[model samples]
Structure formats: C-alpha cells, structure tokens
Target: MKLTKEERIRLTYQIGDIIEQKCRRCYYNRSDDASFSINICAKCPTGQTLRQLGRYFDTEPRSRGGKTGNMPDGLTPARVRELNDQGIPDKEISIMFERSPSYVGKVKNRWRKHRVMARAESGAEEVK
Candidate 1:
C-alpha cells in the first residue's frame, strides 16, 4: 500500500492546507460521533506551550536565557507514537527523540491507562 510520489505530494499539500487554515476547530466542532483524525493540540501557537515543548525538539543548545536546545527532532506526538510502536526503551527513546525519559514514561503511562479504560468500556476483560 505504498503511495506513488504524486499521491504523497498531493497528501502533503492537502495536510498543509488544512493546517494553514487552522482546522482544529472543525474537527472538535463536528456533531457526528465518528472520530476525527487526531492533530496538534488546540493550544497551538502559544509561546508558553511551545516553550514547554522545548525539551522535545532537537533544536539548538539552550542559552542561559532559557531557549530551546538544538534538538532537531523537536518533539511531536507522531514521533512519540513511532517510538512506542517500535518498542524502543523509554530511556533510549528519550535520547533519540530529544525528550526527557520521565516525560516519555509519563506519555507511555497515560496511553496505557487510556487503552485499559477503552477496553473496559468496550466490555473486554483482561485475562490474568
């Protein structure tokens, strides 16, 4: 199921258009219960949030003035998913993903709890 180059370009342009339009509201505002594609959090474009996110990106070395480090990876939720899917250890994932190990641990913990809740809600009992 590989996409041709043209398909990849088209999909990328479409995604860019949606992001440029700030389509977050549309996703959340939809009335139907069908799940919408997950995206960047609603609080995007905020300096405070972006600053908090500095730990995630492999940007530049942090100065004494408290700037983001030179972590080019620059943390994104997609990267989190990818690392988790690859079964990478949290410590290694933290380094490779340019994030704190504790932060990675917390994300994994939260995701685990959420999955458990979903399974329970769907009437699936875990086998001991």
Candidate 2:
C-alpha cells in the first residue's frame, strides 16, 4: 500500500524508536550491512524504509510480549519443594522450571528456614 508523506514520516519515527529501544543494544553488530548501523538521534532512512515496506530487520522475533525472564507458568513454590524432595538437583529444577539455579536454591533455603521456624514454634507450644 502507498503511504502518504505524513504517514511515511510517522512510520519512520516509529521504526527508529523500535531500533533505538530494542535493536541498538542487541542487534547493532548483527547486520552485515555496515551502512545500517543504528544511531538513536540520527534518521536511518534505509532501515526505516525497509521496515515501512513490511520487512523486519530486528534480531529477535516479535512475539507475545517477548521473553519472560521469570519462572515458567505452573511452577509454584510447592512444586519446587516437591522436586527437591524427590532428589532433583537445583540446576535440574531450574531447567525444568525455566528459572535460574540461584532462584531454586533460594526457594529451597527459604522453605528450609520456614520449616525450622515452624518446628521451633511447635516445640515451644508443647513445652507450655
């Protein structure tokens, strides 16, 4: 479809904003075309024009809100404790839950501490 001059200008600005926010950091050196180097303040006519023509030059695919760095869906603290109880290593649990190993370790530690505190409280109640 043919875009009017104003529409073209708006599209260019939008593409430039996308490049500046997303592409500049991750995909700046990925493009073999040396002339396509991203500069946030500069007007990138070639990049903008290509994007205006419905071509995606960004490195990452545009998906549903992109990648979520947190734990995967359905992986709860109870599930983590169950996995740990079943002799699953933190690294393996992290992989299974799509979270970092450190996060799994922290969860395990927190659970352990909670259990210890609960035992101490129960023992005090029994003595009283």
TM-score of candidate 1 relative to the true fold: 0.25
Q: TM-score for all predictions?
A: 0.25, 0.29
> Which prediction has the highest TM-score against the true structure?
2
lDDT of 2: 0.57
lDDT of 1 by residue, 51-84 (tens): 4443334345556743433333544344555566
TM-score of 2: 0.29
Q: For residue 78, give model 2's deviation from the true position in Å.
A: 1.5
Q: Candidate 1: where is the Cα deviation over 4 Å? A: 1-87, 116-128
